[model samples]
Target chain A: MQQIINFFIKNSTKLLFLLLLVISFGLIIQTHTFHQSSFISSANGVTGYVYENVNNFKEYMHLKTENDALVLENAYLKSIAYNNTSVKDSVEIKNLMPAERQEYSIIVAKVIRNTFNTKENYLTIKGGDKQGIQSDMGVINSNGVIGIIEKTSKNYSTVQSILNVKSKINAKIKGSNHFGTLQWDGKNTGYVNLSDIPRLAEIYKGDTIVTGGISKIFPENIPIGVIEKAYTNETSNYFTISVRLFNDMTNLGYIYVIKNKDIEEINQLEAETKDE
Target chain B: MNSVAFSNIARFIALLIAQILIFNNIDLFGFINPFPYILFIILFPTDNNKPIFYLASFTLGIIVDMFENSGGIHAAASLILAFARPSILKFSFGISYQYHNLNIIKKVTKDIFTSLEVFGYITISVVIHHIVLFGLEFFRFNFIWEILLRTILTTVTTLLTCILILYLIKPSKK
Candidate 1:
């Protein structure tokens, strides 16, 4: 026992270092596997508070650009609203019933913390489960898709940004049924890759890509990006296309969280079908 | 607190602010990021309390990791760097490293050779930190070339910045 105490006293520094290193490694493993390791994440209360203040200060610096974007979006929304009112009046004249009910609702939230310099990037927003946000809800800006909600605390949530290496979204070419998986190559922040596209799909350099909506997370036809380059794979018969995202992901501000109302029903029906 | 403890605390806050607010945002060429925060680990007094030093490094690393949203990679790398610091000092400063109190603001500002030795010490330490950080970040053997390229590029950038900051803080002869 004396010798053991002496040994520990002599090499206490090394032992402390080893212990801390192991803890760090454990943290990395936990975050990578479960992705629910929110205790040490930026969404934690203290860290979230610090990031919120910092981002608020930074947001003030970009208010002009943000205001300009808001103005354009407001104009577009007003035009759509005007057209809808006229259509509704004409439908009343013809004694026609209203169209189908809305299937998705949008929750506006502010990005309080964002990181684009890492391999597995995440964004922290100012809304959480308390604000009707849950994991797997789709997040989008006015321009295009941003990411999906990964985890949530009471007053804040973390988003697994589309720039992350683990991000994979279902996307298809606009005006056609050619669908593929959208993934980041960890090369460029502005671009992502669309793989598993059959070689016969008519793809062009400037074609638009939108969400496939095969899953219940997002509604149909949410815009994703534009194809920058398309080429056939050397080892496989599928075409791998490069898409330049419309949303400048690095400079995100206000974003919308999409909640599909029929998601639970759809999932239950799909599970029942699979059981058979 | 004594002047030593006060100055160390000040250094910690200054480095943390610079790392999180300034260096974290500077993504040069889309890949090169100079982490000057490793200077705190590199310049920490060797004869000081080892356990406290290790703890300080771990806390600094974890805070940086939280800000960047990189889960514990920086903490792991910072601990490794701090653990390896004594040997690095011995190698860079030779037997004379044992004689002089080689604190950067005091003894390192005395001569040209001493300043160069300090630069050498920082270069080695920063390179090791960056290699470990990028290696763990891109944890695949297939990305060995990328890891090497990033390590080299970021090492040069960080080393130059450290030397410049050191000079700005304490202008050495030559």
Candidate 2:
């Protein structure tokens, strides 16, 4: 026993290093596998509560700025509502009967907790299941698509912000029919990358980008950004385009959760196709 | 209770509040968010009991997890830190971590080595927390490179933050 103890004492440093390495590696594997990280989902739910409380105070600090921005956005949208001249043809109206050319619904919610720092940014809105918000519900600011609902609790729901790397939306270059997948590049919160646009298309810097009606996450032709730069890749068929994101992801406050009455059918059809 | 106990509690609460509120909002270069809360974990006096140390760190970490919205990531990381801390302390003192001899912080020890050791251990553990966090949030192998980059960047930012916080949360003499 004494000899064993002596040997153990001498080799302890190597053992400690191995132990920490193993623990960390195990965490990496567990974290990498989705099945193992469900623990994280429940834990995030807990954080959901904590941020909900903390943001109550924190959100107030940004209230004046948010309120001012909200007012400006409200006025801007009001202008769009009254005058539809500059509004292009692609902005789809969901509730449009033949009698109504354009129709829309807007639900108001305040940003409780906003974390744009992480790669997967999240916004905790002061609305929830009871407030008619559910998972996969589309969210937007006056700028463009903010995010979709990732998790929902009783009084609050978390939106996957446009700044998140997990967020992807189909968008097209303004004036050109070519569309590409838009995703956050994980470098700048205010910018995202538009990939898969055909290189042959008439593309240049400063051209506007807008959402394609390809997905239910956002409506068609919603203004996304202006092309910051565009270049062809080794895979020569596509243009790797960079876009200056429309929304100021860092300072998101008041948002509208756009519940499309037809989204259920849209997602259902996609899910069936995916299964097939 | 001793003044140090109160100070420890105060430090814990202050660090938690700062991390969840202030640092959470900061995103420089996108992947970095330095967690200063572990400064509280690092500053607990060597004379403090191991159980209390573990309990305090775990509780603080759990509270943080509640805010990060990632399940068990914070708690698991804190517990991992707590579990590994004694071993780290043992390595610092160049001795075994038996309970009876635990208060032997009076002995002259490796000051520089200990600080770096603690920093390395805590940084690695926090990286574990974040890797679990971002990885789960984006469940795909395609994001492996991004996740690793984010963890590294965030760890660097957090370490700078931890060092700055250490300057503020000084150990009070009994």
Q: What is the DockQ of each candidate?
A: 0.61, 0.24
Per candidate, the number of residue pairs that clash is 0, 8
Instruction: Tell me candidate 1's interface RMSD.
Output: 1.6
C-alpha positional error of residue A217 in candidate 1 after TM-score superposition, expressed in Å: 2.0
The sequence of per-residue lDDT tens digits that candidate 1 reaches over residues B15-110 is 999887778767888667799998788767667588999999999999988877788889999999988888888888886765776664565434
The residue-by-residue lDDT of candidate 1 on A85-128, one tens digit each, is: 98987676542523455678899999998778767889999998
CA lDDT, candidate 1, residue B55: 99
Highest DockQ among the candidates is held by which one? 1
Error of 1 at A21 (Å): 1.5
Error of 1 at A71 (Å): 2.3
lDDT of 2: 0.68
Q: Quick one: best lDDT, which candidate?
A: 1
- Candidate 2 stretches with Cα past 4 Å from truth are A1-53, A59-64, A81-104, A267-276, B1-18, B22-32, B39-63, B70-76, B96-100, B104-174
Using TM-score as the measure, which candidate wins?
Answer: 1
Clashing pairs in 2: A40-B71, A43-B71, A44-B69, A44-B70, A44-B71, A47-B66, A47-B67, B34-B158
